[model samples]
Target: MNSVRYTWPEGKKCAVVLSFDFDGITPYLWRSRHSQSKGISEKEQRRFGPRQGIYRILELLEKWEIKGSFYIPGVTAEEYPQAVEAIAKCGHEIGLHGYLHERVDELTRDKIEETLIKGKAAIEHIVGQRKMGYRSPSWEMTEDTFEVIKKYEVLYDSSLMGADHPYWINQMVELPVQWLLDDAIFYRYVGGGASVNPPANPATVIDTWKKEFEGIKKYGGLFMLTMHPWLSGRGSRILALESLISYLKMDSEIWWATAQEVAAYHQSLEVEGKNACLTEMIDR
Candidate 1:
């Protein structure tokens, strides 16, 4: 497992990017695409994210005086215009997620391209400008997905778990993410005979995050946290997140930045002859 030491701006030891996937209820809808007997329990729970959870998360970020990157689906943006607008107005990065939280691997190349165009249009219509970065819905991508993103000239992608720091996937910057740092893996639990287990305790989860952050900081890698507004918007989870934020802020050597900013810096590095090694699959 190799890592790239990104030359973070301002002589920081490492870069920290907090990204939120504002899916609203799109993930639920996408999951229920095949069944007509879907229950409302999970759908309503997910709706709480846009309707209430997002605002709480926004306020928390405002209190910390830190901006986060928000990747929103087109349907989520159309459904929750106010929520999406608030994020942009508060000086956060808004990136494309998908049209309806569609799984890229499950779609054809044409469908993937259509979704990218529609998703970009939806965000631009609401925010008055197109963004540079994109995160695939459900963190799933295919060969066609990569080609479509490259065709659109997206600056970077945060869906892949390739390197610990930013790297180049051909022309696009890859800000890798891991499931260990995502909130949904720990806190998204909906009942009604659907849940396999209960959600993890927030304190325990945050402790694990802190340990990972320390390790990443020691190794001088990127600590990119992927979270959901609906899942991490809960009161206790928010408190846990704030605790982590405060703890990280105690060390002023960390470079806190948006995903786009980090990607741009990596691009700058490439121009300065700091090219990231290309990754590819080889026959076993």
Candidate 2:
């Protein structure tokens, strides 16, 4: 818990960031690097994201007039340029997710840096600008990942789970996330995989998210939701997201923002000397 409460813009009690990892066929290819050309079934399943899932998710965001942060792999962006371009056209923030949804921890430092550069270039090619944020493919980052991202001058990262609120890491802001708030844990299932967990009830998952939001509001912290278009864009599951959004909007005290917006706001607070106590928490 924060010893001192931090203030939010417009007198809002808490901040919320709705983030989506637009992983198309990259995850499947990453899992089976040798089967890229032969993994027809797996590839097609994952392709649902670019083919239909992203459109559905985009429609929901548009209907609610909300701008989300989308983390796209270089492969996904390259393979689905039209989908990526549409996301940009909708005024959503694009962030780097990796070159092929590769886990950074498993890569060497040089590989990590290379992937970051490639991923940024791919997104830039589609969005016409460099992304200001990053989220690791599997919430796994190497010790050198931060340094690599810093070299790129990325403004923030959403992969770490160090805290409930945004904090500085080296030269970048870290908007932390937890598995409990991620939609994948509740819905993702792989056939014939070791330790397969069945999907949880959508209503129960939404209730849990609402409870998390209420607690953040009580403490004036940030609520960051990590979602995957492939997992949560289904008709039945999307209803939970819609309900959660509607419920949150019923209260005017929540500051709904994209990850970049929250990062910029935190930076502004530091510049104004209003974030001294918050920075102290990070130091501790």
Candidate 3:
């Protein structure tokens, strides 16, 4: 491996990719059972659901002057074009999340491709452009997911089933996989949150990210945060978000950009023939 690394964007120094998975943008669309069988309140689920999360995230991004990638379900985008429009206006990248919040592990390869194409179309119609990125619902990616993503020539995959660092899948080195973040798997599973009163150590979670960001900055790569619209939208989680951004903003070493911008920057560098990784890529 070459000791040299690719330089980040002109004004940007390190790469800090904060990707949000805005899954349930509407209360009605939430797949959580409507029945009170489980003793979960509809209001509680909806309040902590996708729409609220997205709104909170948008405000936070605006406050921090940061940009991020938002993966939207097709139905979510169709139902909430205003939200989509706001994201576009705010200059955040929008990518495919799925038409329904169905997990990909249960779906066939054909179904996956169909969903990808259809969802991409619907999202494009709502957001007014074809998104180059794709993230699976529930972090449920199958073996065939990568093949289909490559087939679509997707610029990247911020999907959670990946290694610590970013790397190419198939013939393209662009669409690197994204693993985990605080919103989706962390607050829900990583901690002993038997009740909301005493959740995971917030500082530890923040430090985990701080360490991840430091490594990415040190090695010149990979700080993909998988924030969900529903989870990170409220309470202590939002404060955690604030802390993370405040820390990052203190040092302007990273490029706080949308996913598309990051992909485009890497693509441009690949075109420039300055990085050995690109030079060795014969397909380029």
Candidate 4:
């Protein structure tokens, strides 16, 4: 397979971006089509994210002195301004995650633009600065979504799984994400009419993550971990995240960064007219 040879800051072997999707109750309401009565239980379940899970995650990141990228929906920020404020105050990067966690593929062009504007404004209000990154709700984006994001001048997007390395998406840097690296695939569970999947073993999840990091280290690529506070903030699962953070920190060669930092670095290289070399590698 084709590979990309990229150099991280300080000549690090690999780059790792720790990110969280702070959806809160917006996803539940969006999935239920604003039918709060039908999704009350689900909404409350997701409410744990803003109420408790985010605090736990924030505390963990603070303890490690690691700043993470947090994507928040407009409605989530509006409803829980204090929680959003706390994240910004912690020196973490906040990115856009939509106005109500609406799937971009399902919305029209106008709706997409509207949500993008509203989401950006809401996050900017809390962070007191313009957000430069965006991760589509549910990791689903339409073709028009690209145009919409560009119209808003978003610096980078993390919704695509095209490659493990950072690549260009028109004017925006594409910091790719993968399902295997997302915590929702392992920990999402809901009752009633909502879909449910069996949670994976925390040990196995962390083990897989460690192996992924090893691969990135070998190839000198970017490793983006997509997690949600509600899913990974549970008592047991949070331990796995803490362990993973500790493991990554043990290696001084790993360049830890937020999504915005990664994007800026890539942009700097592009402006310098430097190209990342593509090579083929054989696994031993």
Candidate 5:
């Protein structure tokens, strides 16, 4: 196996990124686009995100004095403009998710392009600036998606899990994420046919997060935590997140940053022709 030991800003041992997918009810609408059922239960569950979960998350970040990256769909932004405005006003980074939380793998290249343009425009209109990053809906990506990503000149993508840290994918930086670090997998229980099991205990989930952060720090890489307001915004879950942040704060070697900041720092490194490539190893 071969790897490159990337150096973080200020010679920090590991970079920590707190990112949120502020999906609201966009994902539900997308999934039920073809269904005739007028189910209000699931829709209301998802709405909890924009209505209350997001604000709780914002408060948590403010308490910690750290900025976070929020990826929101166009429909979500349009539906919850106040939430989007509050995020921007709080000085956090907002990135495009999709036009309707549409999965890139299910759409054609043209459709993907359409989503990108609309999503970007919708978010930029509220935030009053160009968005610098994107996280594919459902973390589904394809070559077609990458093409549109380049077309828009997005600085980074958080959908890929190719590496434990940020790496170059052509001209864009890939701020990789893992399933274990995402709260949706653990806490997203919408009930009915969509939900499979009960939500995991927040304590259990926090233990896993703490372990992963320690491992990432020990190995010197990025600790990118992907969370959803609908899932992690609950009171108990928020407390658990607070505990995790407190644990991480005890470490002085961690460079806390938003995804865009990490990507910008990674881009500044001359990975192609300099000592920025800290280590490379190959095993037979």
Candidate 6:
């Protein structure tokens, strides 16, 4: 027999989860849009500085005929409630990204608890739902974050690059932290990481993304990509972002649901202990 034994989620058609993280709906960057961000360090400010990025993301989703998840911070909702309304009106899922998009590196357990609680309250008050998903900033999660997530009863967390597929949370496997993310691949991260520039050209980003998308098609699984409204909100990058949508529209078999839908489906299957079929079907 071949030594390359396939695990549970091998070659499955993927279920793509298009997730937008903190700073999108929030107007924290509204001022930056008007003038050059002065004095502030590039790394420190870029995280929250994307006022128009939201509009561009909305346009991209509409073009793709896809619905996405928006994980906003508590301060974001408290600050820009109109964007919260717009997100709901546009028919997208809203999740929590904490109160200020603060990373675990900078917080203690008490602070994380305080911020997360505030974030949930602000999002629910504005978006009209107890947000179901949570993503830590920069995927820089601490041990405390997990305990807090479990405490809040979040359906799933998407900040980790732990797998190439959406494994059942708490199920324990070598899997992707996020099923789809645009940060490292498209958006530039500090320290000149992969996000600094995608491995290929702007046009190629979609091509590579589609290659992954096609893998999901075969396997019947999910694709989770991250994007920032600031960069993709304008210029040639718009074409780059839109191309993925253009390609996704070609396939009708794909179900463009929120992260909640996927997590719920998998969790329910696991609870009833019908995981074998679910796994095989998801793996396609």
- The whole-model lDDT of each prediction reads 0.87, 0.87, 0.68, 0.86, 0.88, 0.64
| Model 6 weakest lDDT span, ten residues long | 2-11
Candidate 6 at residue 231, lDDT?
49
Q: Quote each prediction's TM-score.
A: 0.94, 0.95, 0.78, 0.92, 0.94, 0.76
**1-284, model 1: which lDDT tens digit per residue?**
77545567888989899999999989888888888964677888899899889999999999999999999999998988989899999999999899999999899999999999988988888889665689999888888888999998887888988778887765678899999999888987888776788999999999999999989988788999999988999889999999999999999899999999998888788778753343332101
Q: Which residue runs of candidate 2 sit more than 4 Å off their true CA positions?
A: 34-39
Off by over 4 Å in 5: 1-4, 275-284
Tens-digit lDDT track for model 6 on 51-160? 55677778778866778888787877787787778888898988778776777767899898988888898888876666477877666777788778778777677766
| Deviation from native of the Cα of residue 82 in model 4, angstroms | 0.6
Candidate 4 TM-score, true structure as reference: 0.92
Q: Distance (Å) between predicted and true CA of 87, model 2?
A: 0.2
Q: List clash counts for every candidate, in order.
A: 0, 0, 2, 0, 0, 36
Candidate 4 lDDT score relative to the true structure: 0.86
Model 1 CA deviation exceeding 4 Å by range: 1-4, 275-284
Return the lDDT, model 3, position 91.
80
lDDT tens digits, residue span 1-284, model 5? 65456677777999999999999889888988998886799888888899999999999999989999999999999999999999999999999899999999899999999999999889888887774798999999898888889888887888988778777665567889999999988998888878898999999999999999988987788999999998899999999999999999999999999999988877777444543344221110
Q: Give per-residue CA lDDT, model 4, range 1-284, as digits (tens).
A: 56547867887888998999999988877977845474366677788888899999999999999999999999999989999999989999999999999999899999999999998888777777774788999998777999999887888899988667787765568898998888888788886645666778999999999998898789888899988888888899889899998888899998889999999998888777665342121111
Q: List the residue pairs that clash in candidate 1.
A: none
Q: Report residue 131 deviation for candidate 6 (angstroms).
A: 3.8
lDDT of 2 by residue, 35-62 (tens): 5454366567667778888999999999
lDDT of 6 at 17: 72
